[model samples]
Target: MTAVVEKIHRGRKFDQVLQGARTVFLRDGYERASVDDIAREAGVSKATLYAYFPDKRLLFLEIALTECTRQTEQAAAEVEDDRPAREVLLEAAQKIAEFKLSDFGLQMYRIAVSEAEKFPQIGRAFYETGPQAGCGLLCNYLRQAVDRGELVIEDLDLAANQFVELCKAGLFNERLLGVDRKTTAKAIEKTAKAAVEMFMARYGAKVDA
Candidate 1:
């Protein structure tokens, strides 16, 4: 039997391994983390850990990719509605803001930022899985708006990127800081509302939504 097959049949708890790996990676950062540390954290033998992930990089990469895919899918699904394009996009941004506050989201963004300069591959994969996918989902909705003459965008792709960038510029920074301040939920709502309004003003024809 193949190594991969054996690993699968070994009754390995890959999900638990990933959870422990995520904790180790987040606590130690990518460069400082090690296979032994991850193995110990996961309560698995080194052999078992290696049977699944070849190295720390691959393990962290898988974690980031999984999170990115999950968040993107959830974000896309949350914004799915017959509401106006502006409203839908704003709702998506709000959902993204909420996600940014989650432990997994913060860790993923931190990993990407810390390694992006030295390890472009990690950054690229994170972008492809997260922002790029989110933009694609948003572009699909924007294209529909264009069809109805709701936006004067000559390029739906660029518009989608711009919209995401606009929303992220605020939420991403706040999240990177962990937003630990004891701000009220009302303040968060205000911030999200303003971000959406500003974003809509730039590209929206009818901003009432």
Candidate 2:
């Protein structure tokens, strides 16, 4: 019982540290964020921060993973079994598109791209946790749609990637390059609808009369 209580306390402290680290990293970016700042933000001593996270890279990786996993899960949860494939896909796409355009997402993306050459692991981690995870979720949903005769996709993986890529068309690059940051909800909906329409045209199963 004592050990369990101690473990709970440790976990709480770890979460506290992570929350603090997240604030500093997002506010300062990966290159500018410092351990001292993280410690101050977390309201913990440098020793305590180091105790939870061995170094800045590992800490940043954890933060990135948390954000990516959260977004992936949120998108996946939008896929309902009873909803029409087009509706489900469009809804999921809108959510994902919005997330990709969010300030946090943009900052993390910039951090990953900027640090990719110096810290390839960070880039890999972000890809695995963010885009790859999102793709996997969509693939799983597509397979289910195929099973239900809603889609005629022979290559689930390719279709999944294509659908998401279609939804992100024009928006991701524009936002990433700072050419367009104020993308409205209507634009996102239009993009998602277009993506769904294109995907349905290619792979949607024809209904029997």
Candidate 1 residues 68-181, lDDT tens each? Answer: 788777766676546776677667766666666555567667767787888776788788888788788888888877777666677888877776665556556665675653
TM-score of each: 0.72, 0.82
Clashes per candidate, residues 3 or more apart or on different chains: 0, 0
Write down the lDDT that model 1 would get.
0.70
lDDT of 2 by residue, 115-171 (tens): 778867667778888889999999999999999999999988898889878987998
Q: Candidate 2: which stretches are off by over 4 Å?
A: 1-12, 26-37, 54-57
Write down the worst ten-residue block by lDDT for model 2: 1-10
Error of 1 at 55 (Å): 4.1
